[model samples]
Target chain A: MSEPLLSVRNLTMRFGGLTAVDDVSFDADQGAITAVIGPNGAGKTTLFNCLTGFYRPSSGALHLQAAGHVHRLERMQGHRIARRARVARTFQNIRLFPGMTALENLLIAQHNDLMRASGFTFLGIFGWPGYRRAEAAAVEKARYWLARMGMEERGDDLAGQLPYGAQRRLEIARAMCTEPVLLCLDEPAAGLNPRESAELNQILLLIRREHGCGILLIEHDMSVVMGISDRVVVLEYGRKIAEGTPAEVSRDPNVIRAYLGEEESAA
Target chain B: MTVPAMLRDAGLAALVALALALPVVGIRTVDTGAVLGLDYRFGWVAIAVGIVFGGRLTALLLYDRLPRGPRRIRTKGLAGRSRTLVRYAAVAFIVFAAALPQLPFSDRYVVDTATQVLIYVMLGWGLNVVVGLAGLLDLGYVAFYAVGAYSYALLAKNFGLSFWECLPLAGAFAAFFGILLGFPVLRLRGDYLAIVTLGFGEMIRILLINWTTLTGGPNGLTSIPRPDFFGLAFTRSPAAGETAFHEFFGLAFSTQHRITFLYYLILILALVTGWAVERMRRLPVGRAWEALREDEIACQSLGINRTTTKLTAFAIGASFGGFAGSFFATRQGFISPESFTFIESATILAIVVLGGMGSQVGVVLAATVLVLLPEVFRDLAHYRMMVFGLAMVLIMVWRPTGFVTQRTPTVRLSDFTPDPGAAR
Candidate 1:
């Protein structure tokens, strides 16, 4: 009803001659959770990258009307996409600055704020009250995000030292610190135990309800996806075969044929 | 994040505080000026200057050294803090620097040595941008130095410009050449960049050596005017009333005034150098440089224009080198190709490396040691470089990563704050 917070129109991604993603389009409603599901190499991550400014689409338009402005995602670069579009993302394979502590990782995500804190001078770092205030605010924001992720006690620990599940959560926390309107998660539930997966579901639900944020996740874990996703957009070989409510998509022949186990398809 | 900044800050502060306090606090001055801040007549002066600089630098990084309370500086938050701190620190520096030169001191030579040290420190900071921050190992930083020197000499001789007048022109010309050198080697990196830069340095020197009509060939440029006070040179003049510099101060000018003036000049310059580099580290370009240093791919992924970042690193670095170069030429009232050599680059590189790649304090420490050690070893000048070479090897063997144990992350300080996100 509110013009779908973000709209992707005929998005296609090509790597030289190979087409990784072709003619994919979807509408992500404002403040709704949308799950993009596929097997390995379904171009889910590629699509996420395109949307987040890591890869500029070969052709298509991505528009976002959030916080009172229309932004063309295709027109932005990676950092700008993160900053201007307010699009924050977690990588499929975690990319926390290895040497940095878990908390430092979150702060880096808030880099745009540092630009404001500098006041464009070395002298400004000490003399400018604005810089000091901005610094304190950024620290406050980071603290809020870290605590929300249940990493308050382990903030001093290195990101690499965090357990697999904690690292996954850290990634999400890092992204949230950017204050994004849309949070893109790539296999956030991967490598997590059932308990962790359930915890992750709770976290996502909280993010959706509390922040009113939109989530676009790429997950192969059927239980987690079915358990949490409000809507499922099934991607088969980079093509969307079924898009509907989780139950409806699960019942669709194409989705069952491609994603369900062999016995289920046979039945 | 680089070693030089950290090492310079740490080493300089330690040396300065120790050197000055030791004599007064009864840390007996060992007669020989060869070991432990004891070399040369001005050995203690070198140490005093070293420590003050080091201490200031330490104060800047004090946040990093202190015990980081668990989770207070979260890894997630660290990235933000590291990047932002540089920006904030830079701003504070510029404003405070306005009142610096007026700070009074007793020994004049301490000030002079401090100035020379400051000049080198600036040069080291610039070279750190290329080799330390950008991950470009340039062995030809002196090329910019040569360019600045020649630019100043030729400008003054041809245009009748004053020392102050030639300063900016020297910087601009050096920056122009830095970019010119950068354009052709856009694809090169690491060792290749080093070789190209090495060649660039040699090329400048050779040109200066051969350009007889302009650079005066090997004989060197002479009659170069020294820096003046308004229109008055610091020379002894009957009209000035006082033979001793202190008389004007109502105390006595003595030999110390000359040292005092030169010391303050370079100190201010060094302070400016610190300020400029710190400021640049925060600008969009500065982040690009750090990103480039850490991971070129990520830097590109972030949409940082590498071409601009690399060129700016070069241009900025070269501009500082030029500043030092101009200062050097003016200090001696002479210019020659002999001073601009590959070895000079290597020595400065050693300062950057020994100090810690991107750490400003580290390099200052390295510079203080690298420059003053040899001068202090004036008795063994013949074996000075040999001793220096061995010391470098020893330090590398001991602390291969650098004298400073940790590097400042590219992220800012906010990450250290308790994060509500983590708690949830």
Candidate 2:
């Protein structure tokens, strides 16, 4: 079988004395959705942060294999992780450029590509033909994402003015604009209603099947975790207790106890 | 909330004002012909207390009448209409400025004051790139101006270069200094960044004062060559090989001709600066700067390099400040550290802020008001500042954000074709 898209070995992150993510390990494959499930403060975000280069891990090896290249994700910076590693993420809370338009938010995700085409903006300032063509292509891509998110008409509206669900979708569309090999989503359905969550599941499935990018998701909504995710990695107190197909992990006795605690363990 | 509550509030305020005035404005030392005597001006105190009480009561009543909640939508519509009105006003102002020197009432004093206003407008636009679009609060903006002026002075004196030759060089030097400051302050944000920039501005001034050999110390460098009309000197008598401007044009030599030329030069420079800044707003770098301003973490996730993006803003903004500074040196034919001070920085910042942070047209309007307010109130002597302060307070109370706070998007949906075929 082809190697998994991403492999994490012994990943641990600590804040002074508190180990947020402790010896967590998982394999997420290309064209598959892997959901990391945990109770609050089970280090789900900490793991995502480590993967996206927001925090330097205490000890870990993160290797992303894409397009015949092996990228050591642990060695890169926050922006380099997105740029060179082709890894993009949406925050737990939406972090769109509120003052900019939805179209601009997508365009910014394509910064590296546009920056090169603009000759680092020297050619762009003078509106060189090549830069103009590149910019038009970029705007086209932004429009495409807007249309896919059912927001094509609202392209010019400021991102902050968008409705709550639209903002969440816009954030995902912005991440997709980077064309990342792996998309990390932190609680995309946190504020979403059931209908929106269902829609979000379809979008995730479409991204996985069409784009063929590995998806690393951290979610608490069991419907989303069980209905769509092909693989499940259960983390308990910053430690991975089970990793398998969704059906296999859901039935695991250890997983159940970790999620619902042992009968008398607390008492 | 009620009439009685407001009356009580006003009464309490009046009592406090009386207590404060009793030790200050209520008493004065009078020269009683033979000896100085304390004059208890009880009537003045009563008048002051009465004014405060009436003023507070009136203000409270007006505040109660202000529209709230649902009426805010009308205010938004008003903002939209005002934006259009501002655009028209901007065009009219530009036309009036262009014809100022040619107007019947024009003279050296008028042209010079107008020139000073243009200089501040240019500087405000430059700093707007950093503070307005990029969200970097720069307080040391005057440092670049000083650098530009000093760079022009040193270059013209030492290398015998003309003003045109030194203009770009001065801008480049200021840009270099901007980067120098940028490197250390990249990690800072908001108020911390502002404090550092303030310190940086003062540092430049202090450095100029002590760097005697280069900047001629506090006395400053005098007799700096004025910019010529190309190679033609603005003089009655032509140098051996050089042509006098009047002679080249076959017109009479008048000092007024030079003054008009200087005015037009600055006007052209300022217009170009405005044009370039507008163009930049539509470009990728400009969008990146605005994006960085809105959310640094989001910018990082989008793969925009924070370092280069911020440095570019600093460099571009500083270059414009430098250009204005070079023009200033040529206009005055003098260079001094005193010309670039914290107050100058504050005034330029005030123009940007009062105009509206990201509004280009707002800067021009604000610059005119800020620069001309002092001149218009010159006869008021010490009271001029009080008048200025009152005007500022009134403006703030009226529109806390700015005179024009509406932001026009750099690009619109109509600007591009949204091709369905582009979707993967």
Candidate 3:
């Protein structure tokens, strides 16, 4: 009933003669999980890239209303989309700073806020009281995320050394440190074991409930999609084929056809 | 060990020995005043070949006989012990450096060599900020050094500014040049970035040569004022209305005093640079640089402005280079484009790389080795470079990451209380 936090209208991305994301539109509300599901090359990633300002849409309007401000994400640069529009993302492949410790990775995610507190390193260099306080606060925030991700003990260890599951959680924790109004996760559950996937679902649920940030997830795993997503948007051939509740989308003929193929659909 | 394997190794060593001996031993000519004659040192070659054969056989036998698991465990233990030993060695080195001038046998030559070492140490540390911490692969670092030197030279010559006055101004000018160079190469990465920076360095050098009026051209500026001890010149005799440093201190007016004074000045500057870089490592900007080094896309996703982050790294790194350059000009009492060359950049880079990128102590150790090794082998003349190259190759083979591979993280979550209440 309340206004959706992010409204995407007629978003399209073209590469040469091919359309990667074609006229796809969706509304993701705050305090909810929105899953975008598609097979390989179904343009799910392109759509995510468009939303996060990694790619400029051929034609679209992305309106993100956060903290009583509406941001035109299409007009913003990639970094501006993250900093100004309050959009944070985790890559399909975990892109943690491998050499940096898990804690440093999280702290760096809070760079803009800390940079502001440090007066762009001028205050920080001198170890001003204000910068010290902010730094302490940042460490505290990083510690909290590390603890929540069950990585408190491994906080001092390099991110690359962490187990795959922990790295995935750390990536999400890093994005969370930016305090994004909208969190976009690309295949966070990919390569995760069943137990890790269940844990991820719980974490996402907890984030939606407590943090109250809207989550946009792209997942190939149907169990993850059906288990937690409040709404499902099925994309096929770079176009939205179905949009409804998980159960409704699962029952949709187009969605079934997309997943099972024409021969299996006929059977 | 298999007999066949041992024989194969010996055969390989024999081949190597033959190749080595063929040029110098087999094909040798001698002149005995009146006549030129071909001579054979086959006996010497045979002895060398025999030694190589024996060495390879012994190595293979020893390697085969060693217990693998215990050897690995012993090495692991040794690694841990060596890390602590290295720390203690570093402290010992610093103490020795600090007490060198006060030592009984430290002459002007020793002091001057030490000063040169310190300058390279400072340059290595500065370039480390860009290449090591920021992972920018800057191949034109000497350009900043030139900028600083020229700035000080021109400022002191035309404006009559003191060394102290021109020092910071030179640093600032170099930082400006750093930004100027950084702007065009922001989008470049790795090898491409290296080529552009190399071109930029040469461009600056060429400009210095051609721009005869400003930089004194190829001749360079001369008689640049030396940095004084708060208006106390380290001169043979006091200038009008001023006492010489040695005279003011009631010490003998020896040239060693000035050399010692220069050494201490550089030591202080180098220490300050080290201190600043260490502090900046824990700062947000520094962390951002490291972050960008690790992953650029991730950095952008986290809202770090890549351009600003990179520019700051360049500016800060170049500023230190500038400081070292001005000190160099002051020390030499002259400036020339020749001093700032691709070789200097390569040498500085070698120090940083050999030291281990992002390791401060590593830079000091590397700078010492790189600067002093050549001087120590000055008698070897033509052979020194070959030895130097061999040493570098050996080091790379032994530890490609650097002499110091481990890096201390800038921030640790364990340092803070993991309080959920505080987190809120």
Candidate 4:
């Protein structure tokens, strides 16, 4: 088989004397959904942060293979990770530019492409032909994504004014506009209702099947983690306990104990 | 509320005013030729209390009658109607402004005051870019104005450069200073950024004062050359073979000719500034600025380099300020550090805030109100500033956001319809 899309080796992140993500490593394959499951404070977010260049790992390497080149994400800046490594992420808490329109939020994700076409804004200021063409293409892409999210009618509305569930979906659509090789979503299902979660499942499946990009999702919702994820990596207190297909991981004895707590010997 | 509540509120305000005015205004010291004596002015105090009571009661009644609760969502029809209204108002204002100098009643004083108003309008637009659009609180904007003025003065005095030649140079110099200021305060935001910019303004003023050889200390540079109409001097007599403006135009030499010329020069500059800024708002860089203002972290997440985006705003905003400064130097034929002070920056910032952040027409209206309020109250003598402050307070109370707070989207979907095949 071809090499995995992302390779995280001995990733360790610490704060002072405490190790938040302790030597945890995993590979997320291309065109597949990889769900990272853990209990509270299992260093799930810390690990995501380390992967996205939000935090410097205490020790280890994060290698992303794209365009026939290996990019070390650990050394890059937060923006560089998104720009160069093509790794896009959505925050656990929605971070859309609240005042901007839904379409503009998605357009901003296409900033690098537009910026290059605009000649870093000097040419764009004159509304040059090249810049105008790029902008039209950008608007078209934004329109497509807004349509994909079933939000074509609400593209002009401000992101903040959208209902909570729509805001989550808009955030995902915005990340997709960047055309990332690897998309990291932190609890994309956190506040979603069952219907919305079910809708979100379909969207994720569609993205994997159509876009063929790697997805790294961190979710507490068991239905979402087990329902659609091709692979599940369970972490208990920053240590990986099990890694396998959803059925195998669900059946693992250690995974069940870590989630339910030692089987209660008295019971 | 109810009439009784309004009366009670007004009564409480009146009582507070009376309590405060009794010590400060009701009684005063008088010196006779032989002795100092106390004089009672209870009648004036009563009059003041009565006025306050009546004004507050009226204000409360007016506010009570205004629409309350959630505002109705603006429909496309309503938005289009408002846009048309604004367009009509803008056209009317431009016509009035363009005709002011040529109007039969326009005297030198009238032209000069109008010119002053235009200068503030230009500065207001420039500051609007930084404070309103970029969401960077800059209390040191006048430093760029000062840089532009000094650069023009020094360059013209030392290098013999003409006003037209020095204008862009001055703007570039101010923009350079803007970038210099931009670098240090990059990590800072909001109030901290404001304080640093305030210090940066004072630093420039202090530097001008101490840099005796360069800036001429507190005495300032004088005899700066007046701008000409493309090699034609505005003076009555031509210098050697050079042509005078009146001679070239075959008209009588009047000092009003130069005044009108300067007036039109600034009018053109101000118009160009407004036009360019409006266009820039539609550009990607401008969108980035508004996005940065909305959320910096979101911008970083989207792969936007924060440093360049911010520095571009500062540079562009400062360039306009610099252009205004050079024009000011040419018009006055004299410039000093005294002209560019913290008060100037405050006044410019006030125009931006009062106009409605990021609204071009709003800046024009706010500048007119702020500049005219003081001139209109000149007869108030020592109470002029008090009247001006009161008017500002009234405006703020009436329209907390601004006189015009509508935010038209930079780009609308209707501007470009998507193809049927585009959707995946």
Collision pairs in model 3: none
Model 4 agreement with the true structure over B1-424: per-residue lDDT tens digits: 8999999999999999899778767888899779988999999899999999999999999998898899665434555467778889878988999999889999998999999999999999999889999999999999999999998988998999998889999999999999999999999999999999999999999999889998988998999988889899989877898999999989999999899999999999999999888877777788888889998877877788889989999999999999999999999998888998899999999999998888889899999899888888889876688779889999998888777788777776667878777555
lDDT of 2 by residue, A187-216 (tens): 999999999999999999988988899999
Residue B230, candidate 3: C-alpha displacement in angstroms:
1.3
Candidate 4 DockQ category?
A: medium
Candidate 2: deviation at residue B63, Å? Answer: 4.6
lDDT of 2 by residue, B42-160 (tens): 88889989999999999999999987676443223543466578679768977998999999999999998899999999999999999999999999999999999889988998899
Error of 1 at A172 (Å): 2.5
Q: Residues B59-99, candidate 1, lDDT per residue (tens digit)?
A: 66776667756643222444446546755755675454433
Q: What is the lDDT of candidate 2?
A: 0.90
Full-model lDDT, candidate 4: 0.90
Regions of model 1 farther than 4 Å from truth: A67-70, A101-104, A122-126, A154-164, A259-267, B1-118, B172-220, B236-260, B275-292, B295-315, B372-387, B408-424
Give Cα-based local distance difference scores for all models.
0.75, 0.90, 0.90, 0.90
Which of the numbered candidates is closest to the native, going by highest DockQ? 3
The per-model DockQ list reads 0.13, 0.75, 0.83, 0.65
* Worst-scoring 10-residue span by lDDT in model 4 chain B: B71-80
Q: Native contacts recovered by candidate 4, as a share?
A: 0.56
Weakest 10 consecutive residues of candidate 2 chain B by summed lDDT: B71-80
- Model 2 alpha-carbon miss at residue A255, Å: 1.6
Q: After the best TM-score superposition of candidate 3, give how far the Cα of residue B372 lies from its true spot, in angstroms.
A: 2.1
